[model samples]
Target chain A: MDEPIQNKKVDTPQDNSDVITMRHIAKSFGDNAILKDINMDLHKGENLVILGKSGTGKSVTIKLIVNLLEYDKGELKVFGDEVKDLSEQELKKLRTRVGFLFQSAALYDSMTVRENLEFPLKRILKIKDEKELEDRIKEVLDSVGLPDAIDKMPSELSGGMRKRIGLARTIILKPEIMLYDEPTTGLDPITSKEISELIMSMQEKFKISSIIITHDIACAKITANRMMVMDKGEFVAEGTFEELENSSDDFIKSFFKL
Target chain B: MANAPAASYKGILEEAGNQVLFMFRFFRNIFRFDFEWEEFIRQCYMIGYKSFPLVGITGFIIGFVITLQSEPTMKAFGAESFIPKMVAISLIREICPVVIALICAGKISSGIGAELGSMQVSEQIDAMEVSGANPVQYLVVTRILACIIMIPLLTLMADALGFAGSYLGVNLSNHVSPQLFFSKAFSSVEFGDLLPAFFKTIFFGFAIGFIGCYKGYNSNRGTESVGIAANSAVVNASLWIIVIDGIAVQLTNALGY
Candidate 1:
């Protein structure tokens, strides 16, 4: 019963406080184009939720921001610096400023949770003192609500616990920006809600910007400050959650009715 | 369907090119500072020390079986006294190094392939990379260097064990003492024989480590690829070991080693 509004151009608010900006980004793997001329920006201290079906390149967008995957065309600038032009050392320094939480949490299986947290601290921060490492680890563990998990292996934890630990590892470096690739995927509803809440708390506590990619409506409702729904390698709609929820376009409204 | 064979050939050529490039990266990373000495030492223990029991057992059995099998032929020619000399020379110049390397190809290469493949499938390598940690320097370099150092030492141990097995085989049929058997065994093994064999094992180690790490590090994103990586690592490493052995033998002969 919604009126046709497909022709309406939802204006994205522009600001100088943007931490990540992708101008006309296009990426392809062979013949299959993942992102075709996509333009977006992640503003400072905002949770930007990208909702899309599987393989619509929502995850790919965040990956491009972190330079996990390179875009074939267009400008990708992080913190006002061009990403593709950075040298290896510069790129590494950039990566340290951005934290990425993969879908599987990607916790090193061979390492204990404490070692997992210690990895970035030791490697990137170069913190050599045992006491400092211990204090930082304790503080991060408390933040993630997993203090007892320090000595435990990743395999011993549940999916939610792994995601928490993964989040802990990401923020342990105190990154300015966070990229969460399907943070609440493959979890029970209760656990997913908890994770979404945790994401909000993390933004509040660390004062970090985030780009969260997910298909979970509940998660999007709880976490997204701004939402972008993508279809066929391009974002079809962009607005705040309430604006999108009541959008006149059927395609945009379809997301909320689920 | 018409281009199937050509496509397959192209794929193989592409694989070869990738492997060469991977080797180049390995050499380049070797000079980088912040070398992972702890991981390298750990890899040495895993790839080298843990392989002792299998290598030792295989070396012993090979020596024992060869002596038993060759005894009747030697007796027919009245060359029974030359048995120790023949076993010593053959085992040192060819048997011990090649056999032990093949064994390690099965053990070490396949292990690395599976481990790394799983790591890839699970995105652990990507995680490490995004964390600003150099995975190649940490994982690949340490493993390859461990293989290079440990394989030679393992071959030396296997040679000693092989000689002991030959001694036992000799005692099973004759009254020869350990002293006389060892004396005859070592008398013909010159530095010329040992050096080429030792050097060839180093190449074998490189092949095993290189192929395994390459297969694993570059595995496709699927659970099935883990098995493929492990299988291909073993098969390719074993093949490269034989090829390198053949080439080394020709080079040694040309140089009169």
Candidate 2:
């Protein structure tokens, strides 16, 4: 929030050590052009929120960095390596360092909350020590304000609880990069604000860089160190929350008016 | 409407191609480390042991009904003593395996289709992938292998129970001893007949698991698609079972069984 907002024409400082960089990235499906020459950079330990209405490629842009969807053209790099060029094994290894929280929280319904937490630990982290596993699960559960939810089933949790658990699961790996797709999309305002603050606090605690894709204005204001507004596959505004709020651009103004 | 037929044909081709590719991917990841032994055994319990009671009942009824219905005809031909042989051959070569598969296709395939379909809709699969997990290994391989192992084992149980039912049916009118019934049952059931019947069910099991996985894994992101996946799983797996049965019969017939 303290980061100085750059003017629309003035470029933000770019360093070679940026965790993720995208230049002139373009992606399309069939005849529909979703992303057109998009450029982005996520500095280490920064929360960069991309705000836009639905179908503007806000989520797709972040997804591209994880190589969930390939950029049709232009350059996209994660940890300075070209995403599309990575081998399958490399891509999988890269994904381990990048945590993605889906909109639904996507908890495995068949498993209890403890099993959900243990899944990535056992599967991805290959953590075998029972004591260490329990300690790590408890650490994340407490961080997300759900210490007692360890033994509960996912179906028993409410929407806000599920989101907290999802965040806990994502941050358990202490991923260098966290990708939140509509983290607060389907929750009450109080819950939404809670999630936004959780994201901010987690960023500070873990020193993780994040790309949060959402149209929730409160979410952007609370979580974003720098914010960008995307429309029709390209960024239209880029700055701090207050900077974008005070801008004269009609589109940017309309978003902040609410 | 001009391209409707072509589009339909294209969709089918694409699906077939994807399913084959899916099967290969399943095969590739199966042998890798993290074999999901716990999940595999759990699936064996669900898909195999849970299927036994139903298969047993169906097998018993098939044995009984066949013995009862064919008894009058065999009596007319003065081949009444061959009733056990008739029931055994039908149960082994045709009835038990095919019926068990159909029953399993209805139960297991639909259940898998719905479970995975709902998971897909909820984005759990993507969550697994994004978290650096092998979804195919954890989900598909365990379920498919469970089916491959379970279906055949269940079919064997069915074969044995069917003979019991046949014996009970035989005693309904005539008092036949257990020794007499079993001897006559195995009279026509040769080593050749048993081999094909035993081996053919592996294919049936594989088809049930594969088709169910294909349908459920690829189902679109909608609640309605869950139903579609389950329905289509049953339909496709049943067809695959019949087609495989036909092929096994042809192979056996060619071998002069």
Best by DockQ: 1
Question: For model 2, which pairs clash?
Answer: none
Fnat value of model 1: 0.87
Instruction: List per-candidate RMSD values in Å.
Output: 5.5, 4.1
> Candidate 1, residues B1-257: lDDT per residue as tens digits?
99999999999999999999999999999999888888899999999889999999998988898899999999999999999999999999999999999999999999999999999999999999999999999889999999999999999998888888988998898999888999998998899999999999999999999999999999999999999999999999999999999999999999999
Which pairs clash inside model 1?
none
lDDT of 2 by residue, B149-222 (tens): 99989999999999999999989999999999999899888888777988989999999999998899999988
The stretch of ten residues in a row with the least summed lDDT in candidate 2 chain B is: B187-196
- List, for all models, the DockQ compared with the true complex: 0.84, 0.81
Model 2, span A174-219: residue lDDT tens: 8999999999998999999999999999998899899999989999
lDDT of 1 by residue, A1-258 (tens): 211212212245445688888878999999999999798988899999999889998888888887889999988888777789878987898899899999999999989999999888888888989999999999999999999999999999999999999999999999989999999999999999999999999999999999999989999999999999999889888999999898999877777785
TM-score of each: 0.96, 0.95
Instruction: State, as a TM-score between 0 and 1, how close model 2 is to the true structure.
Output: 0.95
Residue A44, candidate 1: how far off, in angstroms? 0.5
